[model samples]
Target: MLFIQRFVEFAHAFPEAPAIVDASSELSYGELYKQAQRLVEVIESTSSGSMIGVLMEKSVDYITSVLAIHLSGRTVVSLDRNYPVERLRQMVTSIDLSLCLLNEQEYDELNVMLDQGIRSLRIDKPTAPSADNDSVEIKPETLEEIPAYVVFTSGTTGQPKPVMVPYRSLSTLIDWMLKAPGRAGTTLLYAAQGFDVSFQEIYSALCYGDRLLVITDEQKKDMHELTREMVSAAVTRLFLPTSMLIPFVTFNLHDSQVLDDLQEVICAGEQLKINPVVRQWFKAHPQCQLINHYGPAETHVVMEHRLSSEPEDWPDLPPIGKITQASTAFLLDDHLQPVLQGNIGQLYIAGRSLALGYYGMSAQTAEKFVTHPQTYERMYNTGDICVLNEQALFEYKGRRDRQYKIRGYRVELKEIEIVVADSELVEDCLVVARQFGRTTTLVLYFTAQDRDQDLSMRLHTHLTTRLPDYMLPSFYKKISAIPLTPNGKVDLQKLPEVGGLRSLISTSYVEPHGELETTVCELAACCFGLDRLGANDNFMDVGANSITLISLLAELRYVLAYDFRQTDLFEYPTPRLLCATYQRSLDTTQQGAPTVVPASSRKQRLIAIQRFQEKKGG
Candidate 1:
């Protein structure tokens, strides 16, 4: 059955039940159904047999447009309203879109940006059927045949590639989610509108007759505010990318009762690595089930692993677990033959949940979607390297291609290189993912004839127009030349490290010199669990979290009688900055005395250092 049909069934069964709860308002299933029907009427009047783009924020109107497009027997193409206008225009042109459904405020702007032939309808505004308007009827069989939605992923060629997901695949995903363990009374929709996982959050809640809480962008930006909303709304089931889950778990660990209603926490978008902090979090909250969900946009949620109890010794990385009944996964070697257990191979998936293929890219689609020679079944080459363990669970090794996930979003390194190459300032560039503890950041290396001081900044501003913020490299390093191998290929291994370069925090580094500087450096190293730390080492790069920062602040207060706010660690992350700021504070307390120490006071400086050391020894 189609997801829309299930929504219709639920609406009729529980009309007064709350279907969607946003920050400002709540919509019942009855009201949601009526609004969707009104949107269907608009679609029937303006277009037929074409994909409809829903460009809006996460709100009731956005949800209404999605349901309306599916109910009207057309595919829904999700367009992030936050994306640049040029990027949205490219997606529209690539999909050959003739009509787009948007909120009222975006109608004028999008109409001006899109081609003249394509029409924009305001789904947010209420519309009534005219006297001459005829009811458009779509058979259930026809709805089953049409694609449900289209989601775009980063392409190696620098263009956004769309994946056509059919209704059957979506239905299968929803069915599996309904049967999954820890099914709660309320599910939170926190993913971005354009992400495929958002569909799972929307449909699973409606299909299972659970309350759906839609998080607003304002609340999502602040973790403390978002946690309060979750507690107030009693959000029981949540799906978050691993990047977000780390902070959420950190918050829960600090309070231990921030999200008492959360029953199930599902993490996806990247590989799940169980760190010591995460393991400790699970042990503290044994009541909450932690699930590692693994899938691509081409096939939604094929494998999941659930841990109800904390293990004595956590694995380096979590297993993806057995394949669900809705789909099948095979680990095939280079020859497309199934690999034996305990051997590494590329993953190929075949099932009813497989996507229809990449939209409007036949050659690319053919390369990825291949048919089995003997079985005659179409399968998707997932490009993921995996191995089956003794228990037959798939353990994720790494990607077989250049594509990698940053903050739970699939990103292609070549895509960043392509955008960077477009800049006139760049001669050649290479982008690579750098891991700092649990966080992954993109670093770019470029070689240019002229090394202007502001060249990196200029290129960064230019790439923002062509790519999303996640695709932007966190650090840029300028090189005189790119090293090459004997085969004339780029020698990525020989590239210089970006460790000491200016990062997002500070423009330059200054070594610690004074006694206070030395003490702060030692304290920072102890807080971050490192034997030694440089004066320039970033706090975030060394796996510092809110809990660590709090502990460090408490220690500083006790040891040196320093009262620094928690925000100080974030604003002044490096030891040099922290020491300098503390000295400034001390000077201010001393009635604005000379800020700089006199060079002539060498004996006085030595005496002060001696007194400070004696105080510490006491």
Candidate 2:
């Protein structure tokens, strides 16, 4: 009722307030509510209780469509824009959708086969009404069915797994959020419509008829542009991943000025690798709240909230946070027995917010969503490895399996390695995550015979560009050989942990020149928290390249205001020389000379990385 009532509350109270905003458009709560109502009218004409597939880029249109589907009594099934067309087809059939909602672009792209008799509502300019009268009051299909959404998880499996979220649980969550009692004002950042975490912004803002700052999908990925919005907007609450949240720390860590208006910083997705960001916020303003939320997609929203001021007692309530008031966490051993505190175990979450189950896979759903033998309540098995403390708060360890988080982005390591295997430069590759000094960074080791690539920079840059910024491996290492076990699988544990970066980047890179270059070189060296940085020293061995590295780069780029790629550092290995080369490149491009973009350089460097990968077992 609370989630359903949220729309009505916002419509009555803040009709004129902006509910969503993208680059060139703004939709007020009133308009959004109206559109949803119209959509409801359209849905009653179709099969009742059918799932409405919401597919499109993140926008006010996409957001409004989802609420409309929910209001229409139809469950919403979100289709991710990032995935391929073939994947959409496979997932659609798996869910057995009755109706699919589409904007023109998505309709053509997906090209859903007409054989299944799936109904679609084409969003076009409205014409005169049909004989089906407007007086007909339509009841919502979900009134009996109860499902509000079906979300797909991005995991190691090639096929996307659908998780059903019901209205009762959603209502429970939205009600609790509205009652969470905060200051008079709260603002939300609308990052993406499909991702469940985006709700922290939407419902949080809708709670008090507060403003929702909707960044377009393009702007969300484009941090340079996003920075402008962050400083300029009159914002208070920011919900972001640790990697995305790192920028604020580097820029504001030393500054005494509190975000002035910024109040609560809710971090979810991946664990917080860097502390300085939240530490600085709390230091600047004692009242500022920094909440680290950890839970799986099954939990409707985050069931934990950990707030700290000045990081008291260090590592106490570190890593991740505790369960929320309405939620319960479990630390289950290998046999599913409850584990003691500090002993690593698989985390299971149980609460009103627990999702219904996997949409189609009943067996898989039964395996994960199990009834706790002791409490007799349903609990979801989270594949994450962590421990439950005495206070009941959960701390994250790593994954139970090979899946890992990089810069707060959930990554299937083998997926990235697959891309490497397909690329020409990689002969053999193994990826491992190394946790040192509270931060877990990724290290890649591979071997090759006749290498022709600058393996480190190419792989780093290639992965960085293709995936979300957080998924980029912080440290890239190419090795002459990878350790193998008797079974011939790469023996990850036996590999050298300290000697990776130099081989990746220092192969043939030269340093840059001049004051800007020199200062950058010095700043990078200092920022690394390194004892010493030499021309040939690799960042892998010295604990370099991370979300922190991206943050540092952003600051430097803002000052430089000149566009540069992370790969640029590969070409100019040393600080001094890299800077000098960057300056020269800028000058050359400015004066009408064709930019001497290095294609061969990227190709060759990738070859070196591939070469090293091939030697993994040889």
Q: Pick the candidate with the highest lDDT.
A: 1
TM-score per prediction, in order, is 0.83, 0.74
Could you give candidate 1's per-residue lDDT for residues 1-618 as a string of tens digits? 667777888787778988988876889998888777877877888887569988878888888888888778788888887777767877888886878888776777887788898888876566676343233355777665467888888998889999889888998888777645443378888888789999998998987688888887767755556777888889988998876664466445555676777888999999886644467667776677889999999998899998754554667577988898768888988889888889999999998889998888999999999987667788999899999999889999998678998877899899889878888777888997765323566778998888757476788788878787677776677888888999998888988875322332343544567666766766665544444566877776554654346546644653455556666888998887887898888877876554334434433433433343243221
lDDT per residue as tens, model 2, 170-197: 6666666664544445465544544676
Name the regions of candidate 1 deviating beyond 4 angstroms.
129-138, 179-184, 311-313, 452-454, 500-508, 511-618
Q: Model 1 compared with the native: what TM-score? A: 0.83
Model 1 root mean square deviation, Cα atoms: 8.1
lDDT of 1 at 253: 59
RMSD of 2: 8.5
